[model samples]
Structure formats: C-alpha cells, structure tokens
Target: MSDDLPLTAEDVAEIAAILEHSGFRELDLSTRRFRLRVAKGDGAQDGLTQEWQWAGASGEIAADVAGVQADPAAICSPLPGTFYRSPQPGAPPFVNAGDTVGEETVIGIIETMKLMNPVHAGRSGTIAEIFITDGTLVTKGQALVRLA
Candidate 1:
C-alpha cells in the first residue's frame, strides 16, 4: 500500500480504539508496502489528541513521551507541496533569523499544482531557525519554522 491509498473514518476509529485499549500511547503499523504512526495527546493542560497516519512502501515508527521539550522551535508546512522562501530570481527572503512573528504573520509560501499557498505562523514566536532553503519540497505536517 501507499500513502495514496484511501482510508476511511472507520479505519481511524478502529485504530484509535486499539490504542486506547492497549495502553500504548503510540502505535505504528507497517507492512511490506505501507506504514503509519498514531500518537495520542499533546501533553498540554487541555490534552489535545493528534494522530498521524502515513502509508508508503517501507516505513518505520517509534514511541516517545508526549510534551517532552525536545525542540523549542517547530516548523510546519501549511500545505503539501514544494516550499519556496525567496520571491523571485535572486530576491531577499521575507524573513530571516532573529525575527519575531505574530500569530497572523505570513511566513512563507507553498506551491502546489501551480498555485501559491501562503504559510502563516500558527503561534506567536521568534524565527529561531529555518529548516529549508528556497525551492525545497515539503510534505504535510513537515516542520518549516521553529518558534522560540
């Protein structure tokens, strides 16, 4: 199976139930041609539950504690496509290191199928780092910026 394979809500619910019963905070399943990882809880006071499912040929999954401050900054791809920072041929970037960003700020753009999608800062933070350079491909849930 591949990531392109269609999945249904029933599949998700069944997987969630399995995880809930097993007392495994995380679960990853993979076959010869497909793989996926599902995790529960965001480790915040509200404890938001988030699950990530990816299907592809040959994949791996591991379990980790939630809310562990592994990285202060996080980069997220607004959309799935190629990510570009520079405006045109040899233009300065919209943002650089040591820059502060508002919650509604436009950080970058992801080009998908000839359309430019604007990326924003999900939360207020500083541009601690840039993970990708100009004209780099990005996938969904892929980190793009790190917050301070």
Candidate 2:
C-alpha cells in the first residue's frame, strides 16, 4: 500500500549510503518536472530516469546542451592505469604550463597491471593545464590535459 507514495529525504539518504557502501556508481529518480541523480564514484553519471511526458522536448534540449565534448586539449589515456606526469622519480615533468605540444608528443604514462603505457597528445596546442598529478589512478576518458 505504501509503495505508491514518493520517497522521503531520509529514504533517499539511506539509499545513497547503501549505494556508496555497495560500490555502485549512481542512482536516479524522476517524477513529472522533478528529477534527481546521485553519483557515488568520482561523481560521474551512473544512472538516470526521466519523466519525459511532463517536460516534453525542452528538457531533452537542455540535457543535450550540457553534454561534454571532446576537445584538442583533452588528453585521453592510452590505457587504463596509474598516470605519471614525469619520466622518472623526482625528475622534472615532461611538460609544464604554457608549453606547446604536438599531436604525437608523449604527455604521460599509464601503468596498467605492471605494464607502462605512454599517453600522447591528440592535437597540437599550448599546454593550458594538467589535470592529474603523478602516481594518480586514472580511468578511460578522464581528462589529463588542457590546450590553448
């Protein structure tokens, strides 16, 4: 009998806690013009449920505008692994702020399960920023660079 009612804040909080402990990445809820989503891992999108009938096409347009795009400054990983910006321990990093990089330039290395995978620049541009630090874990599609 109670299943038809909307969820309370306490219920949502408990669900979030459970999702966090279970290693799930996301959860979503939607009703008419209202929608909610929670991401437990790295704050990336994990789930989505939409009530399309209430908002119509305008909501879809808004969602499309908010989507992320691939850019030249985007330094995608060569493989899934730990990312290191330097060539060796205690050495200066290969690139720094404002350094110009070509498409073939190696920006970092990704260590996957004992194998070293070299990461490269996808396009030529000035190094606007570095997103990850040395010895940090990285996943596929994670941004590692910003270009001018």
Candidate 3:
C-alpha cells in the first residue's frame, strides 16, 4: 500500500484472490522495492502464476506490463535511498538533460540512512534524460539518468 514497503507474501496472495474473484486475467504491481506479476494459467483452468522480482536488483522486467521503454544507457542508483538532484535545496542540479558529462562527473546525490553518497556518471556521454525528480525515493540500481 505504501511505496516504502514491499508487499508481503500474504499481501500478494490476497491480491491474487481478489484478482481471481474479479475475473481479471492478470495483474502487475510495481512498488519502490519490488514488482509483482500475477497471471492466470492458459485456458483458465490452471491456477495463477505469480512472479516476484526485486525492483532494481536484476534490472530485468519479467513482463513489460506498463509498456515503458528501458534506456540502455541509464545510470543506475548504487543503492536504495532518497535521490537529490542538487547539493542542497534551491541549488543548481549537477547535470541536466543534454549536458555533456565525463565519467567522474557528480551527477547527483543519494541519501541513505543519514549519509549522502554522490552519484556519478559512470561513463562519458550527453545526458539524454533525467528520470527521477529531486528528493524522490529511489531503489537500488534504479535508473536515475540516461545518456546518449
């Protein structure tokens, strides 16, 4: 129910039960820490197939249910935390869309457990997109920026 908390096994089961009663063939839910996919088996006779994946760990979507494209050149978060685009409030962001950056460029900062860790551009490239906004919670290995 909340973005900070991942769904438990029981929660998923309850959702599946609801889906079964509702006559929906499939359900895909993505939270900050996990992605849950449920689908009924073929022919509507077999039970549902449930798949759970850590959101940013494998960096793979079992099914592209949302139809969003993944950026191959994305700079991912090193750990789960709150992402900040600037050094401090009201400051200019480290990088913007179309900005050219080197491998060592400090693109942003991720605050985890009261520590601020700088997020770097792992490779040199022009900033193609900024996916996460300032001060948003991000999962480990979540795509923060895309390079062109």
Best candidate according to TM-score: 3
| Number of the top-ranking candidate, with lDDT as the measure | 3
lDDT of the structure predicted as candidate 2:
0.62
Q: Candidate 2 lDDT, tens digit per residue, 1-81? A: 232446544344434434444656666666665455655544355322222223354453112111234565577654445
Clashing pairs in 1: 3-55, 73-147, 74-145, 74-146, 75-143, 75-144, 75-145, 76-144
Which is the better candidate, 1 or 2, if ranked by TM-score? 2
lDDT of 3 by residue, 1-119 (tens): 89788565545554554554466888988887878889866853444567888856766433211112346799987655679999999999999999999999999998765668899
TM-scores for the candidates: 0.51, 0.52, 0.54
**Model 3 root mean square deviation, Cα atoms:** 13.1
Instruction: Report the error of model 2 at residue 49, Å.
Output: 21
How much lDDT does each candidate structure score? Answer: 0.62, 0.62, 0.75
TM-score of 1: 0.51
Clash pairs, model 2 backbone:
none
Order of candidates by TM-score, top first?
3, 2, 1
- Candidate 3 lDDT (Cα, 0 to 1): 0.75
Segments of candidate 1 deviating more than 4 angstroms: 1-72
Q: Across residues 1-148, which tens digit of lDDT does each residue of candidate 1 receive? A: 5545655443544454345435678776665435556666655532223344344424344333222332446867644567788666587787787889888877888776566777888678789888988888765557887877
